[model samples]
Target chain A: MHMDFSFSYYIGLAGIMVFAISGAIAALEHKEHHHDVFSVFFTGFITAIGGGTLRDITLGNYPVSWVKDENILWAIFLGFLLVIFFPKLLTKLRNELFLFDTLGIGIYTVLGTRIALDHGVNFFASALLGMISAIFGGVIRDTLMNEVPFIFRKEIYATACLAGAILYLILNSFSTNGNMNLVVSASVVVLIRIVAVRYNLGLPKIKIF
Target chain B: MHMDFSFSYYIGLAGIMVFAISGAIAALEHKEHHHDVFSVFFTGFITAIGGGTLRDITLGNYPVSWVKDENILWAIFLGFLLVIFFPKLLTKLRNELFLFDTLGIGIYTVLGTRIALDHGVNFFASALLGMISAIFGGVIRDTLMNEVPFIFRKEIYATACLAGAILYLILNSFSTNGNMNLVVSASVVVLIRIVAVRYNLGLPKIKIF
Candidate 1:
């Protein structure tokens, strides 16, 4: 039990650092496109929390996350500077960044679902919100980068979040313990993501033909 | 007084219609890109309310506009179908659509600013939220279309919103009558948009050369 707690703790901290660094690197990489530093920071920060903000707005949740927390602001600023000054330091951790990403997807999916359900959004909309909460940031980021959003390309990313949300809703209806639902549902998302990556899985494309 | 009320009333109704029809027309215009009807509907609807929804979320305003109003949802559906069945009807109205757009920008900008102020967001952010409320829908739509958001261009659209928001703030601090502030502030946005378009004015581009 203790080991599990510490494992998640490290994942949380390390994941944030990796996420921030990668975002910074992404900003730096696009210098030729003429993004001023402020623009870079804007894209990176939105990529980090845009999904949550979108969810909160749709659900009418107040103050949003970063608005109520100064740490998030400072962390973004620090992440931006960290990448600029120590670009060499990121090479070793590039592979492990998905740990942070997976954790984020899991937490955000369940959290957004819960919030939507609380606000009396229909179960269908709640599930969609969960998926939106997990992926919309990437949607916005990709859009800003002038590319088709990757999730629309038959990737398993949104599908995983959607599945996790459905599972959470099902477990909740059965009157499962709240914490049990949280752990199991989130863990399922994490498992699916890791397994998909390990085995090279993707959703089959549609056939309009 | 009656004349003023009726003008705004017509602007309100016509603006929503024009906004929806133009959005639908935009969807039809992109048929070769292979957007399914559902995708077209999603993009068109989001462009119509995405900005206001963004504002409500940032300010913690509850139950956003569309959720509380079934008319908004019905209007989007009707708009979608209108263009598909009646393509020839929109040509004469194309040039006049800007009237609806300008009214929308003016109303959304000042309305967003007032809400943010009520939520105790800092003045700087309030000004920004006002601009976001005015233009972020287009930003999202453009992002989804994989193009640079037109607002990010040196076009004067966002500039007008930003200016109107600041003007509202200045008036609001003097404890101006709320209705008076609403009228004068929104009019300023409308005036700026009209003048900029009339003269083909644009912000000067930076020269790193």
Candidate 2:
């Protein structure tokens, strides 16, 4: 079944850039320990693509995400180069990181759900995939930084993505407008995240017994 | 499609303990940064169980590995308690980390292959699963620590796991006793790893331009 590739591609690319910038900003905090620009760049690249790659492989796709598209590599490299060459500019604009990351999560969630649906997976599984795609990279980033994953910590991370995926499926079942559904689903996630952050809302903590 | 549960449980338990210890040792180097023993223990728990959990979940096994047996959780907790109480002892024994990690790769690789085969997956897929099961936790740990994965960097990590899995399959085809085949295959991996570490042997890097 052929689908509209361009729409998802643009959304996915936007997600990558946002993830890259957030990763770079996170790495900047560790600048006191002698982190090179390359390290930050690579971290961003991994954060942007890591989760999606894992999702794709688990779904049994060959050549993986980064391998199949030269654009991904170029985007990552350019993202890093820009951050490296313009550290002051990036630092000043660091406040925008959360906004971009939230938007990225929204886009990635929709794209992941769409891909899973295309693969003939069930709705619940597609939603799961969507959340995984959206949050896995950030989880990887947090873990690498020796911190617990953001999803497992503060912020409405994976939950927002999951809600968005469910919304996407619900919209798709009732309507023939895929693009509108994607946008609506993504907007749902972005709005939820923004409100959650603004209100300091979060999931209940797991008790260790 | 019922399988023997007794052997699987013991093997899986041993695998968790081994992986947990390796995680503990890896976390020790970061103690100077105020990373407490509890953090170390949690890291160990995730490292030990993460791979198997991912393997089972992706393979469509509900309830996951640690969820099926509460012992896994207790084991990780006990493992952490021991490390916390005997910090100096563990510090003194740091040299054994590589040996323990190598043994972990062997056991997990064999166990993963066996489980995949039991599920009626083909040899190639089973071997791939084995490789994923063995290396993925470490990969996750490295990513969390902001280090490039060991499998992606120095040494033939995943390749050794692949070799062990293939050998297990070969021996099974030859009508070897199951326990004996596991031992032989594990031995092959352990020996390869020991030699690789001693000789600084590694896979040739893939240069992407």
Among all candidates shown, the one with the greatest DockQ: 1
Write model 2 residue lDDT over A1-209, tens digit each, in one string.
23346876766776788787777767777644347767788788888898888667655545667788778887777777777788788777765756777888898899888877776666666776788888888777776676756554455667889899999999999999998999999999999999988998765432221
DockQ, all models: 0.17, 0.08
Range of the 10 consecutive residues with the lowest summed lDDT in candidate 2 chain A: A200-209
**Per-residue lDDT for B1-209 in model 1, tens only?**
11134444344434445556656556556645465778777777888778878777687676776686566677667777766676676565656667778887887787778878877876656776887887887777776565666664434777788889999998999975977897898899999889988898765432221
Q: Tell me which residue pairs clash in candidate 2.
A: A143-B144, A144-B143, A144-B144, A144-B145, A144-B146
lDDT of 2 at A173: 93
**Model 2 per-residue lDDT tens digits across residues B1-209:** 12346654565566677678666656655422224433465568668877876777567654455544567777776667666666676567656656766777887888888888888899899999888888888777666555677677777778899999999999998975988898889889888888888898987776799
Task: Extract clashing residue pairs from model 1.
Answer: none
Two-chain DockQ for model 1: 0.17
Q: Tell me the spans in candidate 2 whose CA falls farther than 4 Å from its real position.
A: A1-8, A31-33, B1-111, B115-209
Global CA lDDT of candidate 1, please? 0.70
- Model 2 chain B: worst 10 consecutive residues (lDDT sum): B30-39
Q: Predict model 2's lDDT versus the native.
A: 0.74
Give the best candidate by lDDT. 2
Instruction: Give the alpha carbon lDDT tens digit for every residue of A1-209 in model 1.
Output: 11134443344334334445555555456433334444455556667667877888777676775555444555666766665555555555555557768887887788778888888888889999988987887777666767677788645788899999999999999975977897798899989988888888997767898
